[model samples]
Each structure stands twice: as structure tokens, then as C-alpha cells.
Target: MTPRGVLGADELNNIAVFKAVSPSVVNITALGLERDFFSLNVQQVPQGTGTGFVWDTQGHVVTNFHVIQGASGARVTLADQSSYKAELVGAFPDRDIAVLKIPAPVAKFKPVTVGTSRDLQVGQKVYAIGNPFGLDQTLTTGIVSALNREIESVTHRTIKGAIQTDAAINPGNSGGPLLDSAGRLIGVNTAIYSPSGASAGIGFAIPVDEVNRIVPRLIRDGRMVRPSLGVTGGGPEINRALGLPKGVALVRVQRNGPAAKAGLKAFSRGDGGILAGDVITAVDGEPVETQDDMLTALERLQPGDSCTLSVWRSGATRKLTVTLAESDD
Candidate 1:
């Protein structure tokens, strides 16, 4: 049984699922303008291309932040060759998801079924349908190599949890759906762990649970709302490098900050004897792999939303619920 390509049994099976969802996947093109001078010249421009799925019949298409960034005009093209101009409905840059609206006929927009990220097990069957390099509605299959994986944020200031897969995701694949075996959308393809700018068997996606939680808020507001503790960490990476568990050692506090107001204590060099600090290993049961993980979790909560912190102190882990205060930023 010689074949022209190295197609495996799993890949063949996944092709069926991909075929079923391909029509629902769309290629997103963001158009904008760059003026030549002060109130002078203007020309229509194309920003970038990313993949997205038909979120609903009302024309909500979900995508990534870096994709439609600075977009003045946008368009979504379906597999059936139908095209529609898109309007930026909403965006949450923190979660890296954007919702675009297209005025297409109701029949053309077929929404994909959403799945839970909490249910994904490592090595489970997963597939990706994307517009890789403008190749329109292409599919690649692989297993979920890991869950709750973190990828560097667009700002390089934080990291976001993504569903890691071995699926062949490429440059233009950002914002495409990462599907489970039952053809359900578990994640949105966001980035890759490749250095060669190609699919190196490591692709990442924004978890559907995160998406499900943030999209509604972004739709209501123009941005994702996050609660703040208003305490700065005391250069904790040095301690972290010396074989200690990682997290900020609370050094300074704002008198009116949520952390201070909630009675969350800190450690000072003069008063140090293994002082009690909230050694944050996780937030809301999601593991904090890095500082970015904490930031991403923080991005989901709003001021006045009470939250419980998983803290470690003196070799024991305890939960401390802290009432959130608004971030001045």
C-alpha cells in the first residue's frame, strides 16, 4: 500500500472531522489606513489575515487581538467563496480574542459548537482548521499534548494559557478553532512555539473556557476588566532562581489597594523570618506557570468581584478570599 503522502490512520480519521467544520471556518482580513501626512493623504490598507469561526448567526466572528489590530475595515470570507465586510464588534486584548460582525445572509453563517476547556485531557484527539498562509480552510490533526500551557502575551508583559497541540498550525492560522474529536471547538488557535516561522509540531490556542468567560464581557464593554491588588513584588525572580517556588514576595503596598485593604500581609527585610506572603501558585484552580499566568487570570476578574487566592505559607497551602478593588490603570 504505497502512498504519495505519509498519512496516518489518525490523520485520515481527523480529515472527516475537518471536512465537516471547514465550511464554518472563515479567513479574516483586517483593513485599515495609514495617512501620509497631517490630514493629508489616505489610502485603503490591509492589516493582516487570521482565521476565525462563525460564532453565531448574528455575525459574531471570534479572532485574535494581533490580527485585527488597528483595523479600520475588515472582511470575512467563507469556504464557499462568499465574502462579507466585517465590523469590529469587540475585542479583549488581554485574552487575545476579538469579535467581528459581518453583514452576511443568515444562511451563510453557521456557528461552530463550543466545547469546555476543563474537559480536555492530554493526548486527546484534536484537530485544527485554518487559513494557513492564505491557503483557505486547511485542516491539520494532532493530539492535545498539554493543557493549561502558557504562551507569551502580545505585550511581552504577561503570558496566557493556551491548549497546546501538535497540530500543524501556521502563520495565518491565528484565531482558528482547535477542535476536539466530536467536532466541538475547545480552543482558538493563537500562536505556535516555532522559531522557523512554520509549524514545528507545537501550536497553541486560547482555551474555550477562557474565551467563553471573556467574550461576553468584551461584548458588553470595549475591553476586558481585571481586578488589581495594587502591591508591587520585591524583585522576586532572584529568590525564584535560588531554588525556591516562584511568586511575588509582596514588598510594598498602596494604603488604599485591595491587597492592603483585604488584610493581605507582606514581607519586609527588617521583619523577615519566613513571613507570611501569598505564594500564589495558581488562581481559581488554574496553575500559574509564570507571572503572565497570574496576569491573565487577573484580566478575567473585575473590580468588586471577590476572589480566592491559593497561597502557600510555612509549608502549607491555604485559600484566602480577597475583595477586589478597581485598577487605576
Candidate 2:
């Protein structure tokens, strides 16, 4: 074979990026408990494998919650092939993000450089390093195919503002880091649009902006403490049956809660029939047509923060300022 000439600028950049970022990527092995039918003995067995990256020198590792879902425990294998038993720190399954901690020394870690996803273009270059099919440390390159895509989480909640790429994300690639050309983490590879359970050149990643927002809270509280309005609303079907406006129709409002204190009335059954209630059409000028939209908007604010809600009632609309409260959900 003829000797290859000096590499091009792009090739050199790819090489540099792979070398710089590969060390931050790690392989995750999920372990589950299984009972032997004959002896009835419970044993820890390998459930699955995925990818993750170092979040900090304190041994915090971030990965998809689904990657370790239902597993009894997990193990993290660093770039040096050193494995350590990991402890679950926290998880926000609504966004498919989880944090694990390893007891490895601080000197053994190299956290990936974090980048923002708010300004990603549709055609910017992106790179993915993951353990596809359990083969660790594989690198694939592609571009941002789309932006602002949405995907469902394990909790059946909508994860908005996802980043779509053609970066060859395979099954084992879940929870891996999706980096930009500068070797900065832009997203965390989560899912793919494939029928055969392989890379179909259509992959989705949780945007790093969301990750950066949720990870810290998870680390601090062990879960995402979403802000709530203390009002139970009807779903789309119920809203449609009631002929309500394009917003959440309050079905029940907790007494003395934020919504109730704000004078938001709930639907009631009168002598004639079901009476109309206040339907929230917007939050602080942001239109919310569904419950998920309302939740998404509220997630942007903190508990105790005051916001204006556009409430629609019989033939009239009014704005109500209500204080948000922390939710257990």
C-alpha cells in the first residue's frame, strides 16, 4: 500500500478532538439481579451497556436515565480500561438524564468541556464518542441534521429542544457525549429514529443547555424539583369534550394553594350541568396550548417566583399573578 501523505486540516482537527475528548468518555455497564429457577438464588447479572462522560473531577458521571433503568447497580469503565463500581447520585427521568458517582481518585478524571446548544445551527459539525455495541471508544462524525426536535422520556414526558444529528448513534451509544468540532460537549446522545435497532443516520441528543440546568439540581436534590401552580387541569380529550379554549382547563384547584389563592376557579357541576372554569391560555405572555406546554414554561421558573397567567372564562379573559410552588413530581 502506498504511504498516505500528510493529513489535511480537517483530518488533523478530528484527530485532535478524538484525542482530547475520548478520555472524558466512559462505558457504563448496567447490572440487574436475577434469580436462578433451580436454586432460587439471586445473582447480579449484566443487564445492558451504554456510554457516559465525566462531569467533574469529583467523580460525577452523566448518562441517560434509561441506560441504567431498573438495574440493580452499574459500573463505569474509564478510557484507561479501569473499572469502578458506581453509585447512583440522582436521576431526572423526565429528561432521560442521570448522574452516577465513582470512587475513583480525582486525578484519574478529565471532565469534558461543556458547550451551549442554544445557538446550534442545522448543519454544524458534530462528533459522537461512544461504546457502540459494547465496543468502547468509537468515534463517529456527522452534522446537526435538525434542531429544536422533541422526544419522549421514560416518564412519558416530552423532552423539548432536542438536538438532532446524523452522528451514527447506535444502541450502546445512549448517554454518550455529542461534541462540537472544538471538543466541547454540546449534547448527550439519547435516542435514534431506527426500525431495526441500529443507527439509521437519524439520532437525537438531549441539548446541553437542558443538561447543564438539570444536572446541578439533580446533584443537589437527587431529582428535578419542578415548579407547580397547584392546579389539576384536564387533558386534551376532556378539554375538547368541554369545548374549552386552546389551553389547560382547570378541573380541580387545591385549596389555599397558589392557584386557589389567586382566585383561579375550577370546573364544577351545577344544577344545569358542568360549569365552565378558568382555562389557562398563557403564562407570562408565553402561549401554552397543552399541559405539557404549561409545564415546560413553568420549568423555566423557580418555586416562589411570581408570574402572570392568562385565564379564559365564559366570554372573557383576565390575567392573574400567582406564586409558583415546588412540586414533588
Candidate 3:
């Protein structure tokens, strides 16, 4: 047999990346409860499987919220094939991200090097490490097929600014890390655009920028702490039926809440007919055409932040400053 010579630069880089980042990757098994038909005894069973990575030395493992959703329990297996019981720490379903903690010692963890996604360009080299089809420690390489893509979360919320890559992400790849050429974590593999539920050369990852923003909060608060204007708005159908402009039409405003305190009004029934109320057209000068748009606009804000809302009331546009408050939702 002929001996292979020196490896190419790209091949060496791939090998280096796989070696550097693979230790941070872990396999997740979701446990569910089942009942035996004969004895009617309840037992724990394997519900699903996915991939996750070590978040920090504190034994926090980050993965997609959908991976552990509805599971009675979960287990995490490190790169060395050592398994540990994981406890749900926190989750932000709107971004499809979740955090779990294991009692493993800090020496067993090698956290992935986090990277930013704001400057990612299309066609750049990327890699995905996951446990596809329950096969652990598999590495696939591809390029950034697109950027700033939108994908829906398990909660049906729009996760904007997603990184689209052709990295061969599969069913069990959920919550795995998508790394750059430098082996830095750039995104979290979440979904694929395939009709047959297999990789079709199109995969989506939650950008690391979003992950960086939400993970710490989840660790601290156990959920995404979003600010609210304290108003319930009508859906798109209601807006279309009423022939309203492209904005969030207020359906109900919480009494003495931020919006109500700012004099925002809600739709009311009168003897004549339904009375139109204030419609929020913008937040802090950013145009918001839908409720989701408004939420995205306020995503970066905190509970005590003050924002100017562009409101349409009685056919005239006006500006109202409202102090935001913590949202219960």
C-alpha cells in the first residue's frame, strides 16, 4: 500500500478544529415517561436525542429548548463517553435555547470559544459537530450559505438573524455548535429545511450573538426577561378586518400599566359601534408593523428603559414616552 504524504492546509485545519472543539461537544438524551399496558406501571424511556456543548466551567450545558421539551428528565454524555444526570437550569423558548446543569467537576469541561455572528459573510467556511442519528462526535464541514435568516422556534416565535449553513445538520444535531474556521462557536444548530426530515443541504443555526445575549439571562433568571408596554394588541386578522394601518392595534391595555399610564387607549364598544384606539406604529423611532416586530424592537431593552412610542390615535399620529416594565409572559 502506498503511504499518504503531507496533508493539505485545509485538511490540517479541519483536523485541528475537530480536535480543539470536539471535547466541548456533548450528547443529550431526553427521558420520557411511559406506562406498561399489562401491569400499568410507569417507567422512564428515551424520548429523543440531540447534541449540546459545555457552556462554562460551572457545568452548564447549552442546547435547544425543543431538545428537552416535554421530557421527564435528561442525561448528558461528555466527549470521553462519561454520562451524567442533567438538571434543567433555565430556558428561553423564544430563541429555542436552553441551559442544563450537571454535577460534574470543572475539570471535565472544556467550554467552546464563543464568537460573534454580526460580521459573518456568506460563503465563509463553517463546521458542525453533533450526534446525528444518535451517532456521537461526528463532524461535518460546509460554508455559510446565507446570513440573517429567520427561523421559527418551538414556541412559534420568529428567531431572526439566524445563520444559514450547508453543514449537514440532521435530526440529532439540534443544540450543537456551529463553529467558524478558527473553531469558535458562531451559532447553535437548530433546524433544517428538508421535506423528508433529513439534511437537504440547508440548515439553520441560532446566531451566537443571540445566544450570548440570552444565555446569561437564562442562567440568572431562568428565562428571557423581556420588557413589556403592558398592552395586549390584536392579531393581523383583526388589523386587516378593521382596515387598520400596518401596526399593532391595541385590544386591551392593562390598567395603570406603562401603556395605560402613558395614556394609550384600547378598543371599546360604544352605542354607535366599535371605537378605534391607539395603534403603536413604532418603538424608539423603529417602525414596527406587527406584534412580533414590536417584540424584536424591544428585545434589547430592559425593564426600566424609557422608550418613545409612535402612536396613531383618532386618525392622528402622536408620540408618547412610556417606561417599560417586566413582562410576565
Candidate 4:
């Protein structure tokens, strides 16, 4: 008979991570109003389920925006089986991140230890704690498959610097913490590249560096402070259709806006046809091939910050300086 004693080093490490972080993880049940087809009456019903983690001892919970989207309200269940009603504090669909507040006591809100994603290496062991498929308190293990990957957000915007892992993130795992072996939060498990809506060994997470930047602003202002250059352009599809190189083509520049103020040219109607406008190829030496890239580049700066734009205009390329401004939206 095999003798049972202390666990192996790896087994012990995995168990230790689970024990430390599980208390911070919580299961979320979102409710929404639905109409009955026959009676034509609206009633509250269970909309969906997802996972979240405690952000602080103040009862603030962080989850994916889609988790509570279209739902009237939600409830958070802790590892101790204590449940509390959650109120939507703020949501930034561009990042698939949302903050919720519960009235639970501070003692019940054990915040997870945060970690930086900037130094993560491929093949490093990682952990994902969430309620996958509605199975609460489930833990999955995997290594960092890749880093600095780009994924689309719920708002159809690009989420840059995403950490790719094979951590078995499923439907219900959205918004849970993707932790390192030390049980520190490195990213928020968001989406999985699967046709069947399962893990499929490819999962993505929003890097904690960005979450660290956006969440505090959401908590304080209820919105992310995304500075804009005030230039109008289409997506990558329009850029490709126009036969232009990889860059955003300025269709119209807002008057008195940052782009206009910086003397950025806009498209003009000519005798032959519509004349091309200045195409922004890079921002502050960072190459931006698509509008998503431009937006991501601009996100690194704040309003009133000066940025240099490498623009192609009228068969000539030149650098233009622009001061960013707050988005009207």
C-alpha cells in the first residue's frame, strides 16, 4: 500500500495558491427582465452567471461587462457561501471590465493579491479561479501560452496587451482573476477562442496593467479617462477597401478639435473626385496600422498631452504635432 504523507512540491504549491486566492473569488448571478410570449408580461428572470473577484475591502467587485450587461441587477456569492446584492458601479465595455459594489461587511471582502503582467514569461505556470459552467470555486492550471496579444472587447474595440493562457477558461469564467503561481492576480480571464463556447485550450485575459489603470478611475469617476485626438476615421475594413496602406484615413477632422487644431488635413472634394486626406501612420514613433492601433496608442496619454503624428499626405510624408483632448462622448 502506498503511504500518504506530505504532498509533492508542485502539488503543495497548487493547493496553497487555491487556498489563498479562493476566498477572493466569487460567483455572480445576474438577473434581467424578460417577457413571456403567451402572457406578454415582463418578469424578472435569471439572465446569466459569471465569476468575479473582490477588488478591495470596501465591497467593490470586478467582473466582465457582459456578465451583468442587459441584466437589471446581480448577486455575488462568496466562498463562505455568504451572498449579497451587487450594484453596478461602472462599466467600460471597451475593456470588457465592470465594477460592482456590494453591501457586504469588510470582513467578507478579502481582496486578491495583485501582480503585474508586464514581466510575465511564456511557459510560466499560472492559475485561473472561477466558476466555470456554473461550477463554483473551480480551479484550472496552465502555463502562459503567449503575451501581448490583442483581443476585441464587447464594444468592438481592441484590448491590447492581453495575456493568452490555456487555463480552461469557460463561459462562466469571465472576469475571474488569472493568477500566477504565487496566487497574485496578473490578469482577468475574459474570452476564449472556441467555436463551442468552451475553453478549447485558448483563453485570453486583460492584462492587469490596464486593469490597474482603468479600475480605479471607474471606481472614482464611473468612467475611464480615454483621451482622444478628435479625428474621424473608419475601421480596418475601410482602410483596406480604399486601397490605402495600413493606416487610418482621415475622412473628416473635427473643427476646433485636437486634430484640426494641430493642422491635420481632412478629405476634400475635388474636380475629378474626392481627394484623399492625411493618413496617420504612427503616433509618437509607435506605428499604428489601423484605427484600433491609433486608439490604443492614444490611450497611453492623457488629455492636453502633446503627441507627434507621422502623416502621409499628397504623396508626401511629414510629422505633425497634436495636443490631445477629452472625448466628447
- 129: Cα error in model 3, Å: 0.7
lDDT of each: 0.78, 0.93, 0.92, 0.89
Model 1: weakest 10-residue lDDT segment is: 268-277
Candidate 2 deviant stretches above 4 angstroms: 36-41, 133-135
Off by over 4 Å in 1: 1-16, 34-41, 132-135, 157-160, 238-246, 265-293, 310-320
Q: Write the per-residue lDDT of candidate 2 for residues 1-329, one digit (tens) a residue.
A: 89999999999999999999999999999999999999999998889999999999999999999999999999999988889999999998989999999999999999999999998999999999996444459999999999999999999999999999998999899999999999999999999998998999999999999999989988998888889899888888877888887998888998888999999999999999998789999999999988889998898888989999999999699999999998867
Where in model 4 is the C-alpha error above 4 Å?
34-43, 132-136, 235-245, 272-276
Q: How far is candidate 2 from the true structure (C-alpha RMSD, Å)?
A: 1.7
Can you write out model 3's per-residue Cα lDDT over 1-329, one digit (the tens) per residue? 99999999999999999999999999999999999999999988889999999999999999999999999999999998888989999998888999999999889999999999999999999999996444459999999999988999888889999999998999899999999999999999999999999999999999999899889988998888899999888888877887878899999999889999999999878999989798899999999888898998887788999999999977799999999999988
- Tens digits of per-residue lDDT, candidate 4, 1-329, equal 99899889999999999999999999999998889999999987888899999999999999999899889989888888888888888988999999999999888889999899999999999999996444458999999999999999878998989999998999899999999999999999999999999889999999999998889888997887778988887667766766776788887898899898888877667998767788899999999988888988887787889999999876788998898888877
Looking at model 4, residue 5 earns an lDDT score of 95
Ranking by lDDT: 2, 3, 4, 1
For model 3, the superposed segments whose C-alpha errors exceed 4 Å read 36-41, 133-135
What TM-score would every model get versus the actual structure? 0.79, 0.95, 0.93, 0.91
With a 3 Å backbone cut-off (N, CA, C), the pairs that clash in candidate 4 are: none
State the lDDT of candidate 1 residue by residue for 61-128, as single tens digits.
88888888877888888878777888787786766788888888888888988889887899898888
